[model samples]
Target: MAGDEDMKEGGLDWAAAYRRLDRLAAATDAAATTDPEQEREVMDERARRLARTVSARATPGHLLELVHFHAGEQDYALETRFVREVLRSSEQRVTLPGAPEQLRGVVLLHGEVLAVVELSPLFGRPAPTHHGPVLVVGQGRAELGLRADRVEEVLSVSRDALLPPPPALGAQERTLVAGLTREGIIVLEGEALLRDGRLFFDLSEERVS
Candidate 1:
């Protein structure tokens, strides 16, 4: 019985020793497979990790303003703050017989006549009816009305969110888009729309004899 007990203890000790040797052999094989190229790859991965950590801690500087709107099937946004008021669909008086093809007609707002332009037509899309709300935009020395399907909402976005304009935009669209945002492209040049003769009636200049 004593001999049998000693043999059992010896077997247990051998099993533990075999497990330790197996673990050591696996570790040795892994170390042997790590060549110079693998070591460089590991170092490069560590450098990239450090770079990302440092960049995340850096400070960002700049702010952006965003104005949201909708055009046709797509939604859009502008950065200009010239928007004064948003008016629902109103009666427009088609008085001008000769006007630009894009010009829909004229509308009276608060005792003043304002030319209403279809925003979709300017973007190379099918023109929308002047039956919707008029986005009243106040430019440097003029107030113009822009007809839109729906005036969604206005929001202020940061500069980091503004993206560069795509190269596919037409000349007119290029002139209108200031920057791209998550909401849409910001119409930085909306004032130019007011400058168009078809969309504005200059009241500042009078006939001089």
Candidate 2:
């Protein structure tokens, strides 16, 4: 296993990779000191290059990385690979009238419009009042903004930790829920949920102010 191999070799050269990326960013910033348009172009190019480099280094296949969060007074875990980033939800979210109840609104994230999903209603629970961070997830043309009452942590657990979902979970929920972690966190198949055309609300047709 890669994790075991890492343990044996101390670990991957994360420090060196970080330093290299930092230096690349600094160099990009220094090169973008000209006009605003030129700076934006240069920054975007460098950022894409940096992202490619980071994504090329894959996480261990045997390790299930999860980002735990709360939505309807219950904890849920999403595979970290599907999570792009987590950001505070305090920013003004634009609501699209006539949209489904599950759709909270749209939030601008990194120059892209992400449809914010209120998951409580999906499970027949009252939405949690505590505003927390939004988990940004992207899959092809669909980008989702999942709000949580609290973001627990990014955990790396062995694949063996995942257990099959209980039969008590309804059909729809079971489809979305991959399994349960060893500690009993409900592990969600976020990609499956995003791909579910019936559950997904396309914000592309809606106007965002």
- TM-score for all predictions? 0.56, 0.65
| Local accuracy of candidate 2 as per-residue lDDT tens digits, 123-204 | 6687554456777776433378888888888777677778998787788878888788877788887667787665565444
- Please write out the lDDT profile of model 1 over residues 6-78, one tens digit for every residue: 1232222223322333444555457647776776775676577446433433122355443466756556654
Per-residue error (Å), model 2, residue 5: 58
User: Model 1: how far is 48 from its true place, Å?
Assistant: 55
Task: For model 2, state the Cα shift of residue 131 in Å.
Answer: 3.2
Q: Candidate 1's C-alpha lDDT?
A: 0.53
Among all windows of 10 consecutive residues in model 2, the one with the lowest summed lDDT is 1-10
Give per-residue lDDT, candidate 2, residue 70.
80
